[model samples]
Target chain A: MAEPSWSNALEALADNKFVLGDQLVDVGISAPELASALAAVAMAQGELGHARHLYHWSHELQGISKEIRAESGKALSVLRHHENWIELMVSLLAVNVAARVLLERLRQLNEAMVVSKTAKMLVEMAEHITFAGEWCRRFRAETGAIPGLFQAALSRQSDAICAWLRAVDAEIGGGSDMDMANAFVREMEMVCGPVTVRHPA
Target chain B: MSTSVEYRAYAVFARSQRGGPLYQIGFVEAFSDALAKTYANLTYDEENWFELCVVPLDELRWVIEPQGVSAKGESGRGGAIVEQRAGSAG
Candidate 1:
């Protein structure tokens, strides 16, 4: 197999961050509570900051202008799968968890450039994961069950999520979709026990 | 659909560089000490801080008034004295 281009990987990561950040800001405006809205805005800003850094680094390495990179198409299907607030929160948690996994994998590659950038991104992601997990746990505690909407959104977005993982895996030359899915499921279970998906038969 | 999670308030302190004194930068809300630390660092990491720490608001005690005042206290300019209290310690 040919070695994956780091520039391509960075560009893809930057695009994902930009799209996710935009969705987060939208969600922030629609969030029901003040605290959640503030947190969503903060997280959205963090995501945009990550995108800016990643894009700048990629441009430094690949000589691509920020405008061109920002204009490039992004794979945002998974983020767009959430239709409601609950679904949006769950989707953010799932996506961030999956992204963290890929980031860790990239960091483990031992490449100086990749490791440094991934490490910084991971620092911001750590707080994001904490916030998301706490919110999910709070939702589960209050409702006593993972809402059907969240479950449905997760099931609907699973394919896109897997595709994202696969793409990252291909870029990093390691990890599998199955492993990433299993890990994500385990994280979801930890946050909200055994999320049930009611599939239409 | 409520997304407000209860979090304890924590006062954040940071040292700008090595051997510098840790001063109050800002505050963050989190459930645990670990989360508080992470939130403090992530939220206020715009500057190159050498170290950061958080203390729960409940952990610190406050002195209501350092200088006692009378109801109709006189000031040097012959005006009523206005008492002011500091914010929470943490």
Candidate 2:
């Protein structure tokens, strides 16, 4: 059988092929294409080799310079996450700390309810407080404030949460029956009032 | 590869000077939520003495730009801020 033609082999393969200069490079089958690709690979390899040598020498020089070493260390911290290093870590930590505060508030609320003997009638209230704190913390950490509860109760998810928080706040405020909720809110306000104001949502 | 990247989101908190409500100041973006918190501290830890909190992106019901709106209504310096997205706006 005759040798397969370049066109036939090229058609059989999935890769694309093109020619450069006087070379009939066949990316899929022709020698010219292979040659060009090989040349490209060689050129890239040479560039990488040069880069590696430069990097080694620069690193050695940096090792000798205390300032450069310190600067590089600082640079590593600064550029770890594409220069958004501080931004990302700090915001999340803020949210986490806030969440902890909220949880502490809930724990106190639960204690208040149990002490007031209102746990049976107001279990949902306690649950709501806990859920809101958790949800707020998670949401803040994940998407920031723009789309979170600050932005109109993201779908029904936010509505449900707001409703729950409002209801709890109301119960804590003592609508009809005199419950421990009132005292709870007052105390929370006393403790978290300064910090809570910072939250936009 | 030079793939284009941009700040997608931010974490911000507000500080209340007097006995007033706290407002959002600025934000920082990162690959994850945890990183955003770290950024929040650096940005707001000084100057205003902010009490920062992690507000979920979705739960943030209100957004007021201090620069865009004048904080000079009946509510005084804290009142003129505009709510960009009062999530619970009925």
Candidate 3:
């Protein structure tokens, strides 16, 4: 496949953010506590704001109109294919953590616009990662079934996650696919410990 | 099954700028001091604070009479005494 331009990558990132934010807003209605629900709402608003920023940046950088850019449906299908809240949380935790790492590296780019935008996004993403980590920890402590649920979610979505990483790598030329996957898994383990899942033979 | 965890209440204070007075912004509940700080930071970071801190609600000592209330005022202080309880505040 031909490598995607920086503009295309930004578009994809924006779509992913929108999808993630939308899902969070939907799931937040059922949050166990008012505090957790409010946190989810805050995170959803932040992610949506980031998406708008990226979309506007892409439009300006590539001379694409906002209307045209908005019509582009490049969101990840994996996010739409979740089975449960636990699955959604696991997938979001993994994807957002990995995206944070990639965005950090992208901030090293010499382009002033890219550096500034990436820095702003990184600060917000740090809070997202922290919130996700804390939620995962709470799930583990309260549910007692989070490890198994996470493992099942990971096994089900591994392919999509790997493909997403590959596409991001192709666009940005950062870490290898294996390296990114390992980093994501390590972060997941830190949040929820060793997840064990049985694979179909 | 969802397990219930007792979250300690923390009172948050923030200074809007350098050398400014630290005013009470809000409160948050968490299972630990670290989580309380995180919750406080996440929930009350709308402003550009010069500094922020969180202390357990139980740690604060309430002044019942503000140093110079007469015996008449003391009779009406029952409400303040009840409100000072840790559980009541939380």
Docking class of 2: incorrect
> What DockQ, on C-alphas, does every prediction get?
0.17, 0.02, 0.28
Give the higher-lDDT candidate: 2 or 3. 3
Which tens-of-lDDT digit does each residue in B71-90 have in candidate 2? Answer: 45763554423443353464
Writing each residue's lDDT as its tens digit, candidate 3 over A52-86 gives 98788777767766563352588778775555566
- Could you arrange the candidates by lDDT from highest to lowest? 3, 1, 2
Pairs of residues at least 3 apart in sequence or in different chains that clash in candidate 1 = none
Instruction: Rank candidates by TM-score, best first.
Output: 3, 1, 2
TM-score of chain B of each: 0.59, 0.44, 0.65
Specify the highest-DockQ model's number: 3
Please report, in order, the local distance difference test score of every candidate based on alpha carbons: 0.66, 0.32, 0.69
Residue ranges of candidate 2 with Cα displaced over 4 Å: A1-201, B1-8, B16-19, B48-50, B54-59, B62-90
Which window of ten consecutive residues has the lowest lDDT sum in model 1 chain A? A192-201
**Comparison by TM-score, 1 against 2, better one:** 1
